[model samples]
Target: MNTDPKVLIVTSAFGDGHMKVAEAIENSFRRRGISRITTLDLFAVVHPALNELSRRFYLNNTGYTQEFYGLLYTMTSKMRPEQFMGRLIHSMGKRKVQRIINEIQPDIIIHTFPYLAAAELASTTGSRMPLFTVMTDYVVHGRWLHPQTTKYFIASEDMKTTLMSAGVAEEKLVVSGIPIREAFEQTQDREALLRKHGLSGDRQYLLLAAGAYGVLSDISSLIKRVLLQSSFDVIVLCGNNHKLRAATGELFQENPRVHILGYTEEMQELMCIASCLLTKAGGITLTEAMAQALPVIVYRPLPGQEAGNAEWLSGQHLIEIARNEEQLVEQLQRLEHTAYRDEREQHMKVFSRKSASDAIVTEALEAIKLRQPSVPAAKSMLVEGQAKTIHGYY
Candidate 1:
């Protein structure tokens, strides 16, 4: 019998960060020769239609009604996760999570997103499946916390402090940084990458990433102003946003200075060649940029987690928060100064925890070899928890 520890990585596709983090963890495990791995999208598996509907609503909410969305997020952040509403939200994927746990009997259950059903299932049933949570943001909310979580791989010391204040044991919080793909961990030839993209390594190039969903409404105007007001060339990466790519390409077809691209697998290569990154404050993208030590400029992050991430990282001096096009241009101009660029790069040096996935995998493998997890086949039952007041915020 070929025996290997069965691993289950549960993630959600509400944001690209969750799935990306799952991929990083899966790839890291593969690299470490752990082949018995299964990756699951909890929401998609449990409620496909609802998952799709909610994802669209989420995109719309964050893109259009960010204030309302922030209010919701803030309210939920203060929630006692085991309470009624919180438990109701947490119960969404319980049945499916239980089935998977029963089927695989995984030695580990890792979460990239805050799908706490597995943690809940284990807690109520007295099972210890070694649930691991990899928080992809600079900030930690109550959603990512569970008393049953085995370990928390967080993005910074600030998050550690937040968790400590929340009563999470210091030993359980690992400041591993947000886990990124293997591509970032490996070195690439920057000059060759520049040539492949039909660019000379001679001039400064500004990379404008329109986020994973291509939701930046002001991207076109923003680029026009950047091209007009600045001395640097522009390259727009409209990730998975076919509409944005097509529209941007048509608009900038006549302008050789602006290079518009669609979804690309070589984001690391692009980051390697770009002088600086102008993008959303999504946790994964910021983590990816940090891995490359790429100076980042986030233009008015949407409220909620984006705002929280921007606020936390800004204090650390890891990224510049530009409130408007004028401020963005000012930030870009600052990048032209060799001294300022070097300063930003040095800040990243202190923040970037290289190969966070590898770090988690190393610890996990050791733990697995050290002691077999005391877990049994998961069983479905009524989840009981008390209602606790969740602080509401604006």
Candidate 2:
């Protein structure tokens, strides 16, 4: 008999943060010798067509329609979990999710997306499978709260306080930072990594990433300003955005100092090599950068979650924000100063939780052990209960 716990990680690809968090958790479980693991994309599994369309719509809106996206975010930001919009969003995927639960019969279900699957699983009669939700952002949204959630692995203490103020049980919240891959926690030899990537160890490197979608507007202008104003070599990661890659290649073809890459798996190494990072404020990316102790410069984050993340990190003095070309250039110059860089690194060391993924896995395993019944005993109880029911009926 296999005693290994079966874990079902439900995530959605609305943005890369959700999938990244799921991957981190999966990797943590694998490292801990938990073999029976399955990962499901909730939207893709429940409603394929809707998932694709909604994903496209989200990217388009976040990339091009800033005002409209901000409007939608503002309109729903303060809604209660039981509100009409929340219920409607959750109900859309509930039936399909329940079907998945019935088929998998997992020991525990972990969610990285804000979906209604938790509520459905909780409402299932006689179901005791632990349901855990990992909030990828620093702020808590109403959509992420469900009374039925067995536990919440949140990003920070302030987030926990917010959830508590909104009536979440104290025991249900755990400040595990954000679940990032274990690689981020390991000490990276900067010189070795630079050599491995065929990059110059002598040159001061600046990394600019626009999330995984390359959605930041006027990236070309930003790159140009950085190159013209700073002495550092610029490395732009155009993740899965071929158009952005092609455009950047054409624009910086003559500049040997500018390196443009597309969809790299060496983000950790690149971040380690960077003197500073100028990127949008995606939660996972920020966490990864923080892990490396790299000074961060955030520019023109999108209106909702990105804005909130930027605000929180800046408030903590862990990052610098540049809203325009001049401020960006100035921030880059500031990063060149040894004292400023050291200050930011010290702040990051204080802010970052290096063992977040491991901590989350430990908590999850303990929670599962407390809730799980011995299989043989569970089967015997079921048989005895059925027999008594039949006898009573006769």
Candidate 3:
């Protein structure tokens, strides 16, 4: 630990979940009084054009563009290295990173996105700096693995096992659940939470979540069907999708039981008040709902990653998957008759007691403290002077 300790967090904007996880780690350090923290959107800062194109692809064509990503994934997985892709990315970013690292002289570095793995690999070429890769997703992709790296923080035991099967050393892996917003981990008064949202505590409150794009076309129609068939109150969160929000808003507005919100910061509170959740099976949202002990009813999930996530949730009994609106509603209606509530709670206990931020920060701090400069003089000064400074500040 160095006084005025420098910590760098590298992430990408490929998905909101990755950035959210990175920010949660940064927030944890900030809470511990580590103010000298820098967060880099490696894609934006290094390859702006590529980042924009990727963002546009996800927004405009992600639903149909899996083939393109699949090809890239295949290329990387083959050990081809695509030296050209690596060279191009590094050529654009190397000098800038060298300058930034030289100036900051960071004590520890944490990377949250896989593309940045190349950047970390390049940056630590000859340095002894500890680089911890945080796998924001549940599954381990070839993109995130690098042998020279110091360690990895993964989201689940399944992920850890996946890495082990891939031949990654067991000692280098730490099963830290995905770091989520601190607010999600804290307990909130459900009655007060419902009141704040202009919701009724007595009614069955359902939190409906879809990604920012609202990729699932059946979402609005499904919610409508539920409204007509069930007595529960539904709150729909159509993130950034104005068109979907407006359409859903029109349908739910006139009705007293249905509430449609575009986006808001009261997600934790909403989860607290929600008796159940109806949404796509994104890892963070699924885990957050589980953290709140809310049973989940997953609407139709898109193919690929989301489908995999839905499968994982179903296998854990943390959520019920529906092939269509009819089956989804049937599952929800059954919630009243079974111990489904306690079942979800019991299954979620494995992830509920774990703190993503705590595990990350603890490992990061240890790595920073254990680091010794190549020179004896700098090592002694870092141990005595920097350690005192870091303790005082953090």
Which predicted model would earn the best lDDT? 1
- Give lDDT tens digits, candidate 1, residues 284-349: 889888878899998888888998998889988999999888999999899989999999999997
Better of 1 and 2 by lDDT: 1
Global CA lDDT computed for model 2? 0.78
User: Whose TM-score is greatest here?
Assistant: 1
Of candidate 3, the 10-residue stretch with the lowest lDDT total is 385-394
lDDT of 2 by residue, 1-394 (tens): 2357888787876764777788888888888899887777766766779889878866773445776776787788777757788777777867556666665557788888887565755665546767888989887778887777888998899998999999999999999899888788889899898888788877888898843434345787777788899888998888777788887788888998999888787888888999998877778889989999999988877787888899999999999888888999998898888898999999998889977777877878887876644222111111122111000000
Candidate 3: tens digits of C-alpha lDDT, residues 1-394: 5655678777765553666777788889988888988776755755578789877875453545755654555565423123566444434566545655555567777888765444444545666778888876565566676665688987778988888887789999988777887888888888777777777767887777744334445666776777788767787787666777887777667888888787576787778887788876566677777777788887766554566678876886778898877897788787755476676678887656457887888888878876655211221111122111110000
Q: For each candidate in turn, give its C-alpha RMSD to the true structure in angstroms.
A: 6.3, 8.8, 6.5
- TM-score for candidate 3, residues paired by index: 0.85
**What lDDT does model 1 reach?**
0.79
For residue 370, model 1's alpha carbon misses the true position, in angstroms, by: 6.8
State TM-scores per candidate. Answer: 0.90, 0.90, 0.85
- Measured by TM-score, how close is model 1 to the native structure? 0.90
